[model samples]
Target: MDGDCKTAVVTGGTGEIGFAIAHKLLCNKGKKVVLIGNDTKKGSEVVDSLNCSFGRSKATFYKCDITNREEVEGTMKKAKNDLDEIDIVVNAAGVWNDVCWPNEMETNLGGTINVVLSARNHIKKGNGVVINLTGLSALEPFPNSPLFASFGAGVIHFTRSFGHDVNFRRFGVRVVALCLGITKTNLHVDLDKKMLTKEMGKGMSDFLKNACYQKPDACACAVAELVKYGPPGSVWVVEGSRLFYYDVPDYKECLNLVSQFM
Candidate 1:
């Protein structure tokens, strides 16, 4: 591995899933991680913990809002200046909002765009990987979380499209989406309880209640594997402990699949 391969920038690094991924990167990949998040207190705590586990100066924190493009760009520049070129970028800053769809879209989809655009140039010259954290809702929408599903679907499509961006390809950067299924993360803390409960109904609620949720660490392990194995324009899905390449067929293929019914 190259000397520069040990540096990474992770958005939403204060969150449970993001922090887990950072931990995996540090322990398994031997990467120095710079965490970006809005919560200064939590970010500091996470960085301190990571540094303690890894080594002093191996982990750092940069407080920034991913929804703000300027803040994201500035953070990226500072990270690059401080840690040299970034080998990997993990976009884990997202929200599942049903009360306010527009805000949710801005945070989840727009924030992803801001991070990708800002970090595209600074990614390592070759073999740099960008992992956008999406959800199974992207492929299979849930009733109560329409906005969240929409954001994930948008992110999956955009990740593929952006993988073909001239600058991204020129830098040999690979962009892909990681579709996680029912991970135990803090994504639903701000959910509208009444709206979610009512929208989900009894069956959905029961299903969710009985469903087996993958732990943050388990999901993080799958994400780490995808970071190394996922090709440009691809999407990888993980359910429980099973991970597989997700194939999103084109419209023509869909039409063909339905031709018999027509």
Candidate 2:
């Protein structure tokens, strides 16, 4: 490992966006990437693949559930020991399962609280980066998605407001939320086509299938760029195959642009 290669921890790293971000970090900038996820077997596989693909940068997978505050603290401690000084944290740990209990808040909201609280010190120590991902459902309300809507909305508000920017400024950390429209990922594959059609109404299925969604690998690359340059509270929206950048000041302006498309 290069002494200067910044260490980045990515939650849900076995998934497409997470894996793509790790791969891009390793292959593009030789960043030491540590993947955190519950699926030890698949997560280890991603680590192996990155090792083979980019022998320059080091990659490893640690089994930790971000929802567990203890596990998050333990993982952060171990990762700090391994890397010396943590630089970036990608809070990608999320679950869409709203049909069963209150797992949505427990997993999504709890995981974020853990990730931010665990890495609080690192952000204070040096110029750190945090990227939280949200979805279009965040901006709009859906009828049947009673579960995910609130969580998505919470993520958006947390990343945009909720003292996140104040902390970034106070501690020299860069925390931003990337609002993704729709992407190609295994999670989408799990959704029943019929269910989507039923939930989104009839024509929505075709609209989704033909949507010009960005690939996971590409979004990952963009995230690495964000880590390098994007500022705090900057909401990045990648939609219809075009990457758009919007800050709070110009949000009204950007919102107007969005209205144009709508």
Candidate 3:
């Protein structure tokens, strides 16, 4: 990725998907990565592994609560000072908790906002890119996971708007929303037993059984490719191992029609 990008920050870099993305950036793209996550132990483990693979200083870990704006800012500053410039920022930190409504929403949506806003301030000019991970739930709601769907949908809309923002466009940073297909991740490990045993988890369980889950490593590669070449403000979907760009129509005509009534 010479002249394209150099340094990247992957939020939730301790998670499976995030880790894979970090690895792709470090090993494949040959870019330095600063990982942000709340888990010190897992974060340390991932950092150590990446460093071992790509030599020391290739990866650094920061334990941060993305929902906290101050912490996000501090982490971003430290990363910039440590890595010089941030060319890519991937908001992969998310939650699928049905039990904790507030925390889930805060993590998935609020945390994403914190990262995107802080990242825009630090990203390099003209070639910086921000990739926000959304999911199928965002495009189509699941009856059982209303909160999760809402969070995903919120992120998609926010990302699209950020991509369309005039000032943001001036920065020349590409913003993309990635609709990752169902993948095996730790998010499901502690799912409420009661919910799983009852109707709530049925939909999810069926979805998991039927959904064509992509491997984290493979999806990581696709994400790297998207970061390298995807158009700004576009949404890309990955399902059943298929990766493709999603078209968003120009809504000017609809807006014009509505403005007459207003």
Most lDDT-accurate candidate: 3
* lDDT (tens digit, per residue) of candidate 2 on 96-172: 65554277787777788688778876543546778887776776775545457678778777777733567666766
Q: lDDT tens string, model 1, 48-128?
A: 999999889888899998888898889999999888778888998877655666778888999999999888878776778
Angstrom error at residue 210, model 2: 4.8
- What is the TM-score (0 to 1) of candidate 3? 0.90
Q: What overall lDDT, based on C-alpha atoms, would model 2 receive against the true structure?
A: 0.73
> Quick one: ranking by lDDT, best first?
3, 1, 2
Clashing pairs in 3: none
The TM-scores of all predictions, comma-separated, are 0.90, 0.83, 0.90
User: Cα lDDT of all candidates, in order?
Assistant: 0.81, 0.73, 0.83
Compose the digit string of candidate 3's lDDT tens values, residues 1-262: 3423478999999999999999888766556899999899999999999999988879999999999999999999999998899888899898887667788889999999999999889988788889999777898867878888888999999988888657556778888899888877877664544242367777667766666667888678777888778777788888767788887766774564435553
> What are the runs in model 1 whose C-alpha is more than 4 Å off?
1-5, 165-168, 190-197, 201-204, 256-262
Which segments of model 3 are wrong by more than 4 Å? 1-5, 190-197, 250-262
Cα RMSD, each candidate? 3.1, 5.7, 3.0
Model 1 TM-score, 2 decimals: 0.90
